[model samples]
Target: MSDARAPASVEVEGLTFHYPGAEDPALREVAFRVRPGERLGLLGPNGAGKSTMMRIACGYLPVPRRRGTKVRVAGLDVATQSLAVREQVGYLPEQVPLYQELRVREHLEFRAAVKRVRRRARRAEVERVAGLAGLEDMLETPIGRLSRGYRQRVGIADALLGSPPLVVLDEPTVGLDPNQVQGIRTMLKNLGGAQTLIFSSHILAEVEALCDRIIILSRGAVVADETVSAALASDTLSIEWGRPSSGGGGEGDAIRGAAVQACLEQAWSRFDAAGPLEVELSVVGDRVQATVVSGPVALDELAAAIGAESLAAGLPLVRLEPGRRRLEERFAVVTGFREAPERAKGGRS
Candidate 1:
């Protein structure tokens, strides 16, 4: 059991690692802390070191000698107390490794024994996990004969054997059918708050659903770390307006542009008296688009203010949407797949 006074569930400080012959380090100065019972999502594109970090957290990989590189699980230093750390964490890797010939019950029993459950309590432990993983009906089935989803369940059952305080899953629902995915997601939701969970998946929706906090990695470096709500909220407002027809009695491009600029300036002066806002206006053919970039603020209020100002300025309000970047869009920008014009212009505050 861990000391009662420990302040964190999992801690990694200045963690850096390199494969034996690789050209670059697999992880670089990674650092974060998982509060007890917090469901954290570890996100990254392929080759972003999610697997490497997971292994290190579960004490499967050795801690490098780099200064300040440390990993502690349940108040025990993973480097010095590897066995205890392993006992404190239940791990389900991306690949579900199981004995092909063993029955589901037999495999779980074997895992319980390996995890050092008392001989007399092993049966109860196996049955408990089997029920939790929805494997009670399949206990008699051979591992080799089960579908991919069932095999994954067997792996989860094994991990849950000793009721570890921390559960780390790597792509737990990678290739399951929709039903199977839903089942697994439901199981994970039930596990929330009962144990601290850290899982990695390319499915953003799944991550968003199961995790309270998110850590995004790009090329082995921690890029963005924030709560899901904050990540999804935008710090910019993008407003678009349609230019009046220029044929006979409508306003021309110059007039439309000036109207938009004046409206945006007035809105900024009213709402952003602190003067941290960057407003950009452009006339594109028959439309005018204005982007207002500022520090984190109430987006709805900003939109309302912009709408009222546009109305006062006689500008057509075609679209008044949150200009804040989406999590997916930001992920792409950070991972080097694409560039964001707002980012380049220091628009992200």
Candidate 2:
């Protein structure tokens, strides 16, 4: 990093925000802190307050301070010292804000000047960021002439100017082709441990692949905050009991129900059933298969329990597999995608 200081930390306490004349606040008593050098991903469906939280963190939105409400970025109050906060925080919104007329080098030089990069070192700073974003070859290309991928790279390079302590990217890979997305993803992966990076994305795999920690927002509330490991070990699993003991009709039916009941018993023993576990069982000619959906069931522990129980019952285990990551389910559950009748939108999304 060009700045000769530790990466900046972000702190928000009891923050609530409302757009002009909005009936409900965009955010509600939301609170969290990001440590220096942490890569945090903010996740939510559309209008779930993810973007609002990002704006507040980057000092683009103002917070009305109640007794416990405030937002601090890089040790500066976002409301009181927005300019200073902006100096230390580099932000790229959902739309890549660019002047298409300018050449890449010219645009970056202007950005460096705006960020107060030293006059003598400005050229070197621009070159440094350009290299980091793999734009050294396109320095003289006019931004308007560049492909969408190159344009996104230019935006990234611009954000890296002066090596700001915190870098925020919103949907940075949106609308890119596969190769372009991979390029950007690789560049972002190389940026960790040097700066405080926070971004918002609807892509579960992207967030899972990039972030060390994740915070999920739903309906203007912070619903889940967990490390990547914990978040991905969701409660869904696929379990296969040994092939039905040479049968096809009523025998297979009885065996399927019995095996799934055993699975439920094992799941319930691990933790209290948050309502009955959702189970889908099938008895094929060869094996009895079940897909179990519950809440926060650890894969290893549950698998071990089932294996032991199945062994004692003279039933061999065919396979035990983890279903989708917990983050996806939480995303669906809180965003109301799991329900037919979704909640009405009342907040300023």
Candidate 3:
């Protein structure tokens, strides 16, 4: 039985699943909760069980009767009351499924009927969702003739037919054009405070923009779970400096690198009372980049220490930035993909 006073809009406990002939479980003891009206993002590399988890949450996959998989939607146990749980959730799978032959309005109306929305209320509900998804102008267009963006919107509208409290979207903007992505992002931003949203996306910036909190999955297990603010507020200092003009040859470069390393080590030693600090130094072209990883420390203090030490070593500092660790970088580090894809100069599109 679910607790009547449960504060979460969605809850999962000890959830695990395996395919009939698979050697390992697709999901292993995954657990998390979403409070009412909270937007959460799920991130992971391929085969990380993100889609699997979303499927279970949407009741598309059933939990084994004796496996003790516990999931609830809108305070209703999903395994025990699948239909009721479905009524409280709007799910958009990675692949937007739609009836190609049907018009947008026709498809939404059909979905509303299948979801058992009252006959008299179905039209109003369809219209409301259509408006929300920006399908008002193309409501009568055949779905097959619509663009991918329009098709995604139709899928979203179909999911929203019954005003479900929890909306789960998997890769809602995958393969979308820049304009289309922005449109969907705007819609989702508006929906955040009004709906309990759980979405998964490989686009780190998209997740950062739309989610309040993020849960990162790795090898079917939760690896990193934290608020967007905290995740972005990493305790690392980034320093960029100009390399010496004479440090062109390999030997010169090695010597310069060692000097920079020594400078950082000396600066870090100033905080001997504070724990250990790790430094990673690399030379990109003629520029030197140094990253100092340590526990939470004042950015200004650390920057001052590094500046003073570099001056003593005759190393020229170009820029010092704090908390520049991006969400994608953290994701890569946690998931063991240390070489995270670099973002373009301006940022993700």
Top candidate (TM-score): 2
Against the true structure, candidate 3 reaches a TM-score of: 0.75
Tell me the whole-model lDDT of each prediction, alpha carbons only. Answer: 0.81, 0.79, 0.81
Model 3 per-residue lDDT tens digits across residues 1-349: 1111222388888988898899988888888888888889999999999999999888899965556668988878888888878767789998998999999889999999887788888888889989878889998999999988889888888877776778899888866789878888888877776778899998999988989999999989998889998778756678887876556767777788778888877887787676656666777777778777655557678889999998888888998877466787789888998864332221110
How accurate locally is residue 286 in candidate 2, as Cα lDDT from 0 to 100? Answer: 65
Sort the predicted structures by TM-score, highest score first.
Answer: 2, 1, 3
* Cα lDDT of model 2 by residue, 270-349, tens digit: 66654445666667656777766544566567667767767766566788877654467656766677842222211111
Candidate 1 regions with alpha-carbon error over 4 angstroms:
1-8, 236-266, 271-326, 341-349
In model 2, pairs of residues that clash are none
- Per residue, candidate 1 scores C-alpha lDDT tens digits across 1-349 of 3212222299999998999999999998999999888889999999999999999989899988777888998888988898888988889998888999999989998988888887888898899889877788999999999988889888888877777888999988876788878888888877777788899988888887888999998889998888887777667777789855542124567777767777766766676444566766777777888777645546677778788988887777898886555568767866778886552252312
In model 1, pairs of residues that clash are 234-324
